[model samples]
Target chain A: MKLLLKKGRLLDPTLGIDFIGDLLIEEGKIKGFGREIEISEKDLEIIDCRGKLVFPGLVDIHVHLREPGEEWKEDIESGTRAALYGGVLRVACMPNTKPVNDAPEVTSYILKRAREKASVKVYPIAAITKGQEGKELAEFGRLKKAGAVAVSDDGKWVADSSLMKRALLYAKNFDLPVISHCEDPKLSFRGQINEGKLSARLGLKGIPASAETVAVVRDLLLARETGTPLHLAHLSVKENLPFLRWAKEEGIPFTAETCPHYFTFTEKEVEGYNTNAKVNPPLRTEEDVEAIKEALKEGLIEVIASDHAPHSPLEKEVEFELASFGMIGVQFLLPLSFNLVREGLLSELKLLQYLITNPSKVLKIEPPSFKEGAPAEVVIFDPEERYLVTEDFIQSKSKNTPLLGRELKGRVKTVILEKRIIHL
Target chain B: MRHLLDIYSLSSETIKEILELSENLKEILERPIPKVPTLRGKLVLLLFYEPSTRTKFSFERACKVLSADTMSFSAKGSSLEKGETILDTVKNLYALGVNLVVIRHNLSGTPHFLAKHLKIPVVNAGDGIHEHPTQALLDMLTVKEKLGTLAGLKVAIVGDIKHSRVAHSDILGFQKMGSTVYVTGPAHLLPEPKEAEFFEIRPGGFKICYKMEEALRDADVVIALRIQRERHGEPFIPTLQEYAENFGLTPRHLELIKEGALLMHPGPINWGVELSYEMEKYPFQVILEQVENGVAVRMAVLLRLLSGD
Candidate 1:
């Protein structure tokens, strides 16, 4: 069977193509695309894509599927469905789940479940250390062979410098990427929000920006010394920028990622004790937000990921300090990142590169593009569309975002995956 | 006036009204029969998630003076200790036809959380280090009773200002009432002034006095807060002796203040830590009067919130 997508603005950051064109799909693979494709097949299914932006589906390098445990919050089926609604066709799940994804068995379990239940592709990121205890490193070779894309101790940092150094060198032998969750637990101990006047006024303990910068500096030095390519996850503070710049200038191989919440909100979001705005490496000051946007624009920060930590109201609907950190973000990743383009920080294509191309490169996978014989992982997005973020709008089982009841521009109109066309 | 949550949001006129009501209530406390039938049928729930002796007693006495039924629920031997959430426990209490909730918890914004979820008026007894509205009101009442006015008074709050909910409330309350609030303590015990500047609700910010004498000089009132020895584990202060020597108030310091200036402590004061034991014997010391005023001020709050007076 053949399908024709007629007259849409196609954006392929990988192929560096941006123009209004028609795309053809045959047997669930991209057949060909040009200004106009003349298809004379009577059995061809044609979809009108006027006034829409068509692009390769997004690749989010950080997400939490919460599978094999905590299924009540989110599992592979529900999480991938959320990703599909957000126009992301590929995601790398973090290892900070219940029982922690450290061993090959957990990694294999995630992959097997994803193959059975997920609508989108799922890449399991195994823990860097056994049980994420930060003392002993996990078996990197076995985990990589079990289909794990990378290793990370995401919820906690590898506090021991020697242990982290060993893990960096050890993961290198297996050709596995090392993702570091940069934070000093001692500095951020019992911290609720960004350490500043807000935390002081609110009377909650503060997590100083030094907590992230200190960890970042250590990780960068380790990566430089070990010569292992490192991926820093969900960096939220401005103080880390100078260190990141210094590392880049020193020719250190590293990729830095910042989430939408880091650029979109600040500590002020927790002004009324908003639990949904509480996150680890907590939301920082307005200056930090500006610095993150500038970093993205300057290409110093190459990837924009959704650290989509899902927590039910059981964890969120309590006292601000007692409430768990993080908000569900996978579903809002694209629309929120699109605001970067709207604010003129980055062009639409460049924003797409951060969302799609850069994240794919971090995971060491081929990005989805409109090449012949490539899988038809495409998305139709309506940039002008506006919708309110409500419980029903979120496909994730947990609705724990500060954006709830707020209207957002841009939405996923349709997603074309191999053998299925899902309209959202 | 539905909830006595924090002094930061209380207006100058509102604070004056509570003080005036407290003045009238203090007169009733002097009566042979202090009991009033105004809120005889109302039930005030004292849900203290944290251990508190004075705050709970003050609220209970206020309830008794107003003739309102009181029910006390401490965290020990309660559903809270059995892994039940504070929200669920509060909701269960609210379902029992409780009229008003006076909550104190270890976490900041606990009262705010209950106030958001509950329909009946919720009073913040004390929530973490965030606020103690009634305590601040009572402190304001004590000062006004002695000074006759809250406006234009120089008030100095000394010791453990960073962790003192009373200090947090007093700074905002006094500033709202037109007092220039000055705070001095161990450097680590003092909160950054920039943090308070972010609070737009504050009528004016407090002054951070690095030297105790700077805060005490010519001040109309001086409040010494209890320094928690438990905080030593966190490196806030080197030792209680060091804090007392450097920041504590004594009779010798009295000469630095105005002739008729009063010394206040949101007791139980750390006798030798925040204030010298000799401070209690001084004629200017009004520690007992502050406790007396606590009942009256809380009565004013309960009456205003419950009877809509």
Candidate 2:
């Protein structure tokens, strides 16, 4: 079969391709790309992508598919379907499921399920510790061999310093990236929201910024000492800036990531006790939001992922403290990250690199590009299209985003993954 | 207002109205027949998720005195133990023609959550370490009854300000009525000053007095909060003994306050930890009067919320 995407502004930062172009696909593979591709074959299919932005499908390194357990919230099928609509063709899901992805068997189960059910590519991230209890380390070698792209105790941090240091070194031997969920459980114990006047006024227990910075400092020092590549996930506080800066100056082998919500909202979102805005490393202050945007601009924070934690009403419809910390974002990842570009914090190509290449590098995988003979993993986005984020608009099973009922720009009009053409 | 969720949401005018209503209601309590027919057939559901004696009984007593029917639901041996969500449990009760809900949950904003979903009014009996709206109202009523007005009074709140919902509400309530609130406790016990600033509360709404004596000196009212031993598992204080010695209100410390200053405690007090037992005998102490005024204040709240006046 011959397929032609005509006259779209194709942008691939990896290949330095930025121009009005046409891309040709044959037999589910990229045939070629040029200023114009005229194909008059017998079985020719052509899609006019006029006035649209086309790029490689986004790769989100952090997402929670909620499968293997708690499929009621989000399974691989629903999660990946949401991702596809957001122009994300690939996602590395976190390991903090009902029964955490600690053992090789769990990782194998996730991959096997992804093979049968996932609409997009799913990379399973195994837990760094057994059951993510922060007590004993998981078998990194066996987990990596089972198709695990990384290891992380995502929902909880490895509080024991010696155990975390050893896990970093041990995961290094297996070539598996160590992703740290930086939070001191003791400092953030029973904490409901960001520690500030908001928490005070609401009378909810506060999670101090030191909870994140303390763990972040410890992890950076551990990475510096061990010389192992480390990835810090969901950094929210400005207090982590100096430590992240010192690590960069020292030439530490580490990559830092912040989510779109970290730059989008602040602790004030919890004013009315809005449970949808409730997130782990709870939404911080406006100052922290500016710092995150600045970090993304300076490339101190390289990757912008959707820490797409989804929760059902069972978890979210309770009291603020009882409500689980999370907001589903895999579906809105691209549109929300596009805000950074809209706000002039990042250029279009730089934003795409953060969504595509930088995250692919974190996972140590080949990013999707319009190379000849490569799989046709592409996204056609209407940058000017605006739509309200509603339950009907969301493809994820859980409709638990604070952005619900709000209008967002940049809609994914179509997604091309190999032979399957998904029109959103 | 449909719901009495927190003191922060109540205006000074509304607070004055409630206090005036309580003063009138307090007269009924001293009469031969203490019952009123204000809410003759209305059913008030007392949903207490945490263990409580005073708050639950106070709400029930308020309901009975107002001639409103009352039903109690405790977390123990209830459907909540069977893993039913609080919303579901409250909805099931709401289906039974409940006129109002007076809820006390270990989680903050549980009453607000219920109030959002239910058409019937919801009253916050006490929620977590968040607020005890009625407790503050009753305390304010006691102060007004004794001192003639809530305005221009100096109030001192001592002990476990961070964990005490009573302190949170009292600070907002007392300040709303034009009183200056001074809070002093172990450094860890007091909330950050930014907490008050976030509410856009006026400057001097509440001051953090580091020294207990500084807070007590020339104070018009002194409220001593109970220190929960369970909360001390994190070593918020070096020891209860050390806390009693330094921050506790003893007879010696009482001399620092104004001659006619009122001593208050939202009780179930840790006898020696926050207050010296000997100090309880002082004539200016209004701890028992605070409890007596609790019923009147809650009665006023139920009438205001349910009767739509």
Best by DockQ: 2
RMSD of 2: 1.5
Worst lDDT window (10 residues) for model 1 chain B? B196-205
Error of 2 at A396 (Å): 1.0
Find the 10 residues in a row with the least total lDDT in model 1 chain A: A197-206
What lDDT is reached at residue B53 by model 2? 83
Candidate 2: tens digits of C-alpha lDDT, residues A132-211: 99999998999999999999999899999999999988987888899999999999988889988889878788899999
lDDT of 2 by residue, B1-309 (tens): 889999989999999999999999899999898888989999999988887888888889989998999988988899978999888998999899899999988778888888888999999988888899999999999999999989999999999988889989999999999999989998878886556565437686778878888889899999999985554447677877999999889999878899989999998888888899898898899988999999999999999888873
- The estimated TM-scores of all candidates read 0.97, 0.98
Off by over 4 Å in 1: B193-196, B199-205, B229-233
Of candidate 2 chain B, the 10-residue stretch with the lowest lDDT total is B193-202
